[model samples]
Target: MSSNTIIEVKNLNLTKGRKKILDIEYFSLEEGEAVALIGPNGAGKSTFMQVLMLLQRPTGGELFFKGDRVDWKKPIAYRRRMAMVFQEPLLLDTTVYHNVASGLKLRGFKVDTIPARVNEWLGRLGISHLAGRQARYLSGGESQRVSLARALVLEPEVLFLDEPFVALDVPTRAALTAELARILRDTRITSVFVTHDYSEVPLLAETVTVLEQGRIIQQASPREIMTRPTSRTVASLVGVENMIPGKVVGTQDGVVFVQAGPHRIKSIAAVPVGTNVLILLRPEDIRIFKGVSRHGDNSFGGKVSELLPHNYLYKAVIDCGFPLIAFVNPEQVMGGEVLADNEITVQFSPDKVHLIGQYD
Candidate 1:
């Protein structure tokens, strides 16, 4: 473990009834750094967080905190230094103030000093008005805010949140996400946030770690995880809807030409000629024009095979001898130019293409 690393695990393993649940080779969280753990369902994101918080005991592996090996048998001291929030509020049946003050009281905080600390966090989380409300009577958002206050009032060295905002409504989730981001920045408390929603990763964490089938698949900045996913699973999780198999044909002026099915695509990758590669394009990166015209490089004509409404955008599958997915906004959809079986021109810049070498 490094001097600044607050937590580290080596060869971590977890099992239940002869079935392996987590098998991470190594993982670490640096002090004061916010990191997000993301993956699909059954990816062990919550298991990893539970293990880090000492809520779940790993069947095997070494865990270290603050450059010292952790004693699994006596983890109370470490647990005291950390706090966790879950998807469910899991609040106490008492008033919000008492729920927020429970941890401090258990930690033997002086009676006189507890109220100020509790109130500060309640106010900071924008739940002071709900402080006296019964926990069960509060709305989902209010309960979650109380849960956050309960965790943050302890002022833990490490905070572990396992999809804390997943249960709230969209507008509530968005508002709380922004508030939590600002609070995390201000507090500078090291945190490990686990969520399946990759979109929330950029807002909450500076680094994103993708776990798949009990192992770490990729660890990178949010931008890199979105634009240059290292594996097909990560690609799909990050919304890279277009993954085309192609071979590098040639290079000119720093742009590599790729023959993807019947279309020749331009990319800024440096793969050797004749090597098979996977052309990864985010749906948002592919631009759909009203008609066939050379807008720039990598422009071609395609018919919209399918157009489906996805949230606030439209997901279009274009067939230009190869199936390609693109996301267009509602305005573009309302423009009456893009529709099912409509002939449209597809174009994407060379720099927008990400290539992964395909050994198969």
Candidate 2:
């Protein structure tokens, strides 16, 4: 480990009964960086977090912290430098203040400093008024906030959060994410967050590790993961709406020209000629125009098949020879003419398209 490296796991493997839960060859976390671990259900994300937090022992491989090998027998000392918040908040049947102060008390902090620390964290999480409230009576969001305050009040150097915002509504989740980002930025805590929500990736993660079937399939920055996924599974996980099966017709200057039926799509990504590929297009990357004007590299005529509202955005399903989805601002939907089954032109830039291997 280097000075910048906070935690490193080498060739980690874990088995439960007869099944292998995780098989991570190498993973590392850097100081003051936030990494998101994303995957489908039962993808071993939680198991990996447990290994990092020292709550579970790996069947193979070694873990290091700050260049020193972790001693399983002395897990307590290492745990003090890290904290975790589970999917559900586990609060005692006491007051919120006590729940937030329990960890510090167990560490034998001075009596005078405990209240100040607890109050500070409560305020930081925007739950100062709930200090006197009974933990059992708190709402789902409140309890989660209390759990966050409890873990953060310890001032740990590393934080492991497993879907901390899963239980909250959209607005509350957004608010908490913003607050957590600010706190982590100010404290410079190295953090690993596991989530299934792709929309939250851009808000919280600096880098993202995509896990599939108990193995890491891809690791990259959130933008890279969204725009240049390495595989079809990764492309689907990142919410790419249009993943058309195509054949690589030509390759030049590292660009792959793919032919999907009669459509020719140009991608900046490389793929060998004559090989099968999948062209990924994000819904937001498509532009809808009322007229057949040339604005992008690819243009197709389509008819609106379905219209649905998603919060402040409208999801329009268009039948452009192939079914395609586009996300536009709600204001745009309202300001433009009605999209009902009318012929329209959809255009998307070539750079916005990504190509991934077509693995059956």
Candidate 3:
């Protein structure tokens, strides 16, 4: 392990009830870096986190902490250095202050030192005013804040969040995510975050690890993971909405041109000519045009097959050779002009298109 590596794993394997769960060859977490562990249902995301948190021992392989093999003889000494918050608050049936202070008190902190630490975390998580309130009486948002205070009060060297925001309302989740982001930045605590919601990954993690079927498929920065998926399965897992079958026709000046049905798409990627590929387009990157601008390589005329109001924008399916899903802000471009069966041009920047792995 490198000097900065905080948690490292090698040949890790886990089995439960004769079923294999995790088979990680190698993985590492650097100090002060946050990683988003994400996958679809039954991808063993939780099993992997549980192993790293030391809540579940692996069936085989070694787990290293700060370059030293973990000493299982003294489990509390290692476990105490980390904290975990789950989807539910899991608060004790007690006062908010007592709930936050419970961990420290159990760990043998001096009675005099507990209040300052508990109160400090309460203030940091914005639940200080509810310090005296009973845990059960608090709202979901407040209860989660109390839970966070409970975990943060430990001053843990590493933090594990297992979908901690999953149970909160949308507004509450957003607010708490922002708050957590600030705290993570300030503290620089090594963190492992697991969430099924891909949207939440950007809010918490700097690196994104994509796992699937008891194995890690890819690990990279969020942009790279979204823009350049390692396989078609990964593309589907990451919500790649528009995947058009195409073949690479030519390459020049750092761009590859492909023929998707009648449309010729240009993407800023590298691939050998004549290579079969899937052109991945994000819904947000699709641009709607009222008329044929005829700009260049990325424009295609398609009929508006359907349109639906999605929040402040419109979700549209345009029959442009392929049924392409597009999002347009009606308030900005065509407030009253959009309707089904109307002819419109669908276009996107050449740079927005991404090519997946070479086709079989």
Candidate 4:
């Protein structure tokens, strides 16, 4: 643990009856750092966050705050220093202003100081006009803004967000995410975010931790996680479309050649010859040509098996000995007149192909 680490947990375990919900061996959060916990629905992401916030106690573990041991049984003081926002707003049946001020009152803030803090956060959240409106009468986005104001008014050292935007409409979610991103950046509050949406990770967190079956699978920066997933499961989670199981057939000058499916795929990843591996190719990294091109270096011929429109780009599946997915721009499609069942060329660089060694 570093001197900057604000929170740390060791040997954390949560068991209910015969099933284990969380078995995290170790985890820590540095002061002023934001980390996102993401995985599938039953991946224990929420459970781990709850344990950190002391909402759910682990069966066995030690929790530390600022290098001091925290007593999970009596965590009132610790809890007061942290604030949490849930998926649902869960506001009280009162006016928005009061809802935002309630936490301050409960924490024993002076009556005169509460209004300035509450109103400041309400304004920052762009909901100052709704301060007098009843919480039950506010829209989903409005209610969430009030909830955020309530949490921010406390000026807690750490914040916990549990999929706070999961229930909002796309436009509302995007706007709120933008606002929250700015607030988090400006304040630099240490935080733990539990979310399933990959789109929100880069905007809100500097680091991501992938949890599965109560175990930490991988933890890294968002760019690293998406581009170089450590496992097939992580590749799938981060939207890696082409995961080709292959073997290292040759190596020369730092390039490893893998015979996957019917093509010799070259990659920069270092793996000894004769070892089996999974070749990961993201859809965005592959480029499509209207017809066959003799580019030759990591280029191959393929027939377009499927072409689907996605907003402004076309998602195409090509069978170049091996099936590969690529996102094509409309201009590229029109120039090449590409469509399903048409012969097209697929091209990618060796550095773009990531490899994960398969044991056994």
Candidate 5:
């Protein structure tokens, strides 16, 4: 690797029982940067992570670390520089301190250094108070923290996490995420995380790779992947609720006009004239007004068809010829008039509408 590139996979392919599990043409990770591998279940995210962890060998292609070719026969030597955490905590039936210190013991660290290192990691993971607890008796969140301490205590150059927070409650998940972010920032360790949750991408990664059917469909920054997805599958994976089929009418100046059903929408994106396209809009970007709004370029009269409550907002599905979901504050809907069949206008700025090229 150059000073910038830490891990590089070129034309990697993996197979199990004659079925190809992963086919990545080109992928690279930069030093000290965090990347998220996101996709639906059975998309090969876990299989790819396993390959990187040296638990599985690729059926074809090349993998390099720090510009050195990986030697499969000597995998154990190379694997010491990396550590991984899985969905569940697999703690040994021993004290929390010994579990965190196990890796060091295997590496033949001095007895005097193991306790200090274990204590350091426990404090770092905010589980110092649980150091004396039996590993088998810890709660889910505490066990995950101990598992994290065990991984981080080794000071590996690269870290792999496969849905590490999947089993924790919401508050515990958020707190662990914040703590992991701080540790990664301070340590500057190159990291790869696999997750199916779209919301976790924005919090954990600077770059995201969208995988589908064992292939990388799109890779970009979180903002770019969300706003300018290259394919409809990528758009749906990022929680884009509005993906209306449209035909690009024309482009004038710097704007593109598209026709969806009977509605005309102005887009900041440029597409060739007469080309079929998919217009992607997040529910949070759509605004609802009781009457006409002077701000947005595309506006249509609609009737509120349904109001569904999500975690912290109300998702209102409106029938404006074309259906759309708008997220509004729950407090704003309190004691408000029932929206059923109520006349309303759904509007969105031209910049918020993304035009994705039609993929066959």
Candidate 6:
């Protein structure tokens, strides 16, 4: 553990009747470090946050803050040290200024200094002009800004963001994310963010903890988590489109060769020869062309079984012994021949295909 550790949870578990809600063994957050906690619905993401924020008492084990054991009886004191922003903008029926200063007033800030703190935070959040506007009249983006200003004006020791941008539109969400990133960088506050959006992890956190079925599965940096997930379950979460089962044939020239689905492909994994492995190929890594292209380190022929539009790109599923999804852009798709049931080729470099642990 680092000397700068601010929050630690040891063997924490939450059970209700015969069901387990959260079964975290051990977790720690360093001072001024921001981390993203991500999981699907009912994966204990919110439940675990409640435990850390002292909103929900754990059924077993203990929680520590700054090396001191948390006292359950003193909820108010601990709560005052941390602030939480939920998905919905839970603002009052008053003006933006009042909503931002409400928490300060309840926390017993001096009346004389309330205006200064509120105005400063509103300006910082880019909502100073909207301070006099009523909460009900504000747009979704403005309401969220008010909510953020309300949270930051308190200068709490910890900040918890629970899907704070889920309700905003695309452009608005992007703007809010940039603004939040700036605030986090400037304040260097200890924060724990929870969101189902994996892409948002890189903006706010260096570390990401993934949960599944109430169990803490993996903890690593966003890049590491995306490039090399620990398990097949985690690979799926990180957008691994192709998980081909393969058998290690031999090793040569720092590359381990594997026989997968009637084809031999090379990978950069260090697994021993004769072992079984899973080749994780993301759609973005595979290039699809109408005709066979033997240019890549690994190439295979597959029928273009499906073509689905994914925003600006097309998701094409090719049947090359097994289903292989390749990201086809406007330039990659054949000229005016973008249709299913056509013959195509999928090619990927040996280094592009990530190999995880051996498959059972």
Please give the CA lDDT of all the candidate structures: 0.92, 0.87, 0.87, 0.90, 0.87, 0.88
Q: Is candidate 5 or candidate 6 better by TM-score?
A: 5
How much does candidate 1 score in TM-score? 0.97
Ranking by TM-score: 1, 4, 5, 3, 6, 2
For every candidate, C-alpha RMSD to the true structure in Å = 1.3, 2.0, 1.6, 1.5, 1.5, 1.8
TM-score for all models, in order of appearance:
0.97, 0.93, 0.96, 0.96, 0.96, 0.95
Number of backbone collisions per candidate: 0, 0, 0, 0, 1, 0
Tens digits of per-residue lDDT for model 5, 1-360:
477887899999988897889999988999889999998788899899888888899999999888888999899987988998999999999999889999889877898888888999999888899888899999999999999999999888899999999999999998999889888878888899998777878878989998888899889999999888888778888889898889999888999999998889999986889998888899899877774344458888788899888898888988878888888776657746326676777888899999877663
- 1 or 6, greater by lDDT: 1
- Per-residue accuracy of model 4 over 1-360 as CA lDDT, tens digit each: 899998999999999999999998999999889999988879999989999998888999899988989887798989999999999999999999999999999999999998889889989998889988999999999999998999988998899999999999989999999999999999998989998788898999999999989999999999999999998778888889898889999999999999988889889977999999988999998877767876757888899999899867999988887778899889877876678899888889898999997642
**Runs with alpha carbons beyond 4 Å of true place in candidate 4:** 334-336
Model 5: per-residue Cα lDDT at residue 232: 76
- lDDT score for residue 93 of model 4: 96
Question: What is candidate 5's TM-score against the reference?
Answer: 0.96
lDDT (tens digit, per residue) of candidate 1 on 139-253: 9999999999999999999999989998888999999999999999999999999887777888899999999889999999999999989888899899898889999999998
Which regions of candidate 3 are displaced past 4 Å?
332-334, 358-360
Model 6 residue 94 lDDT? Answer: 99
lDDT of 3 by residue, 1-360 (tens): 789998999999998898889999999999999999988889999999998988888889999998889866666778988998998998999999999999999889999999999989988988888999999999999988888888889988789999998888889988999999999989998899998778777768899998888899999998888877878767777777888889999988998989988878889987889888888888898877776557566988998889888767888888988899888787633665556887888778988888875462
Ten consecutive residues with minimal summed lDDT in candidate 6?
A: 330-339
**Model 2 spans with C-alpha error above 4 angstroms:** 251-255, 331-338
Error of 5 at 141 (Å): 0.3
